[model samples]
Target: MERLVQTIVQKRLLPLVLVALVFIAAKIIFALITIVAADEAYYWVWGENLALSYFDHPPLNAWLIGLTSIFFDNNVFAMRLPTFLTFAGTLYVYWLFACRLFPKAPERAFLLTTIGFLASPTLFAWTSIVYNDHLLIFLSLAATYAFADYFSAYSTDERTSTKPLYAGALLLGLAALSKYNAAFLGVSIAALVIAHPRLRTLLLRPHIFVAGLLCVLMLTPVLLWNIQHDFASFELHLVDRYDRPLFTSFKADTFIRYLASTFIYFGPVLMIPLVAIFFRQRDLDQFGNMTIWIARLMIAFTFVTFTALSTRGAVHWYWGAIAYALMLPFLPILLKNMWLYGVHIVLGLTFVVYATVNYSYAPVELLLGGQSSEVARVYGWPEAGELAVQLERKHGPIYLATTGYPTAAQLAHTLDRTDIYDLDPRPSHFSFVERKAIAPGADAVILHDQFGNLEGTAARFERFSKIETFVYTAHGVDINKFEFYLGEGFISDGDQ
Candidate 1:
């Protein structure tokens, strides 16, 4: 018993366990204090319906959350459980893969895995939201690991393992189903096979073909769903967003912002080593050829995707998360030089301080400072939802309109009503007004100050009593103010 205990301690299992505990504790703490962001709430709605696809993302993540919500209820903890568990699972898998990659340096492998977990800002952000990114990232990493192990096993002996190859294919298929970005894995793997003479066996293997078939089979549901829905998912993702011109100055800013955000979110300490490893040509030979290929592919894909989609949208949290994770094992190799390791430690500590100061459990007012109104504009819908409910009871079946869909969706969910409408003339990003315009009967309308032209329509209607106004503040700034107006000749305030 003493020997076993000693062995476990010496193996550093306790520290890893502590790190995991800290990770979960932080997530739970954040979950309690933080309201669901609009994106999270929207995705929760997607989970409720359990469709094959959504307007924004794949269905696997929603399905997972929806299943959990059945047991845990539609609350923060329930919504975040899938994300939290996926992150934790990814950490474990990273360790497993790291151990396989570095059989001689067990401690170093463990450290690198931990650093990877810490350096992944994308993972941290998505883990807090009920989004598909976490699932996709996990599946992508799994495929990478399986592919590495399978190729390594094949290289050692003539016998090929069907399990790893099949599993890798299945994971890659699921990843593709999660997001179109998974296609890059195939590109990366092909590059690896072409680069390494030892890996040429993979090209000749029949199991690779079998794996491809399995991947296609796994993704059949998405294809069928697209067919049934007139390919709305693809159209929305591919065509609808392309209305903007292809060339834009925003491309440079988008690329730079993504790079900075990724570093900030994942702690800089962990990223420095990864970046150092990525740029060092000499260190590339230390790991399997697969790592080099995966890293290069990820970088190329990020650059290409950013350049192409620069006019459409900025790089989002899950966009390149897996690529970051794939580069984890190589960080230690980069840290082999004392100067590189020293710089990494300083940057890592700086990030720790930044995250700590930014997220300390301070009062909401203190956190908002003077920009409270701006913060409110961005995240004020929840407060608006509360106000909307109060107005609904006072005004009776009120017709609500907003410039955005997120506000409308949140208001509808909170009020347990869907009569809310979008006041915007066209279907803008968050156009909930489209629904409200067609609502039956006379309806009261709510408008934000930012809806410049839409507010003019309210003037043409007869204004009755004004509902109470609520001011939303964020970072001590007022981004938007909400005012409620009843239709012309409706009951006055004194009618009650």
Candidate 2:
């Protein structure tokens, strides 16, 4: 036993293994304890109605959820299992990236990168739930690793191979598919390559064309899906992204929230190193120095874009998580300084402790978001579904729906039913849910927020005579009330 233990210590496997195990355990515990979050449940609904892609984003998340739901039963743990494993994959790939980027102290590099990556409060907290960031982190690491190897080969005096460059492009394409935020990586890489004289020749390579074709092919499903849907998804995701109206009406509160949260999301343990690396620019023609430039470019683009966007809309800090991840491989450089290394270890462990304890308790979620707020998106929803089911049985053949997507999705999920639709005042994916609408002479139940505009919802179904209205109270909350209506010569279309 002593001999085996010594071998393990000598190999420096103990710390990396411990970090993986502890983080994996914390994620599993969180998934098991917490109810399904709103966005997660909302995505769960997307899985129920399988499509090539979804209206809100790409289809990788739905694909992952569908695969996970098959083996583990459609519950919180099952839904989140894929994301947890994705996080695990991210750590392993990042370690490889670290080893390649910094060979002198590979073990120390892996350990600190793990601390900087896994111990990040936002990144760690997100592992417990299903988010596209899981896919983003995984694919982004793959891209980073492949890009470094490719860059190394490109920078060498004798060019040995172009395989890594092709592989990097494929990974980057998939990264964009995972989440749109990764598109900025291309921007960063372009800026650095254009500035570096030796690397500028890459822009003229036929290999770049081959890789670009592969990316286009990988992204075909998303494009085709949009083509069939009149490119609504394209309009919503890509066009609307930059379509913020009236920048003159900027909100200080939005900018304040974004600025305050940006530092925390980048992982507090990494603050000093990220700052140090960003300000320092080395010879890009030199091997291994490219990642620092990439890291700086990523950080700069992410903070600036998100901060500008936040002025016109709400931006969550985790939106920049993948950008922060590009900097992790460079963190091992900080390990040479003993005091900073200690700070990284201390902060990493402290975050792990807090996050581990917090995920298991409902009360502590307040620090992240209140149980009812957007961040917590998990509360009283099952209860809402139970009430809907009870009411549905009373009104036989009645169409059941709500004005909002989340409420409609929760009801559909818990009832183990489908076509439980949402009444969107405008076009949305919920409108495409089976192309469903109330038939003529049908009595229907509509759920809406209690404090919300009832007349606004009732106006959508004006053809139906209002029969009864009552609140659906659950878990000591009087929100999500229901109103009964009887249709008069109902048409297939009114307001989508």
**Estimated TM-score for each candidate:** 0.78, 0.85
lDDT of 1 by residue, 1-496 (tens): 7985675588766654455455556555655556565566656655666666655666687677678878985566777888777777777777776676666665556665664455344455565566677777788888887887777777666486679878888899888877777777867876776667877876786777788889888878788777876776677767676546566435566656766765666556655555564564552222355565676677667646755675455665356666777777666565566454445445544444444334332224446554333223335555777876677677765666654556555565455454665554434323311362533335565645443344444543445445567766545545456766555432322331
lDDT of 2 by residue, 289-402 (tens): 767667778888988888888887777888888777877777766435656655655665676566445433333445444443442334445565666666677775677876
| TM-score, cand. 1 | 0.78
Off by over 4 Å in 1: 1-24, 156-158, 194-206, 242-256, 266-287, 311-313, 337-383, 398-401, 412-437, 440-468, 473-481, 485-496
lDDT of 1: 0.61
| lDDT at 40, model 2 | 76
Residue 113 displacement in candidate 1 (angstroms)? 2.0
Best by TM-score: 2
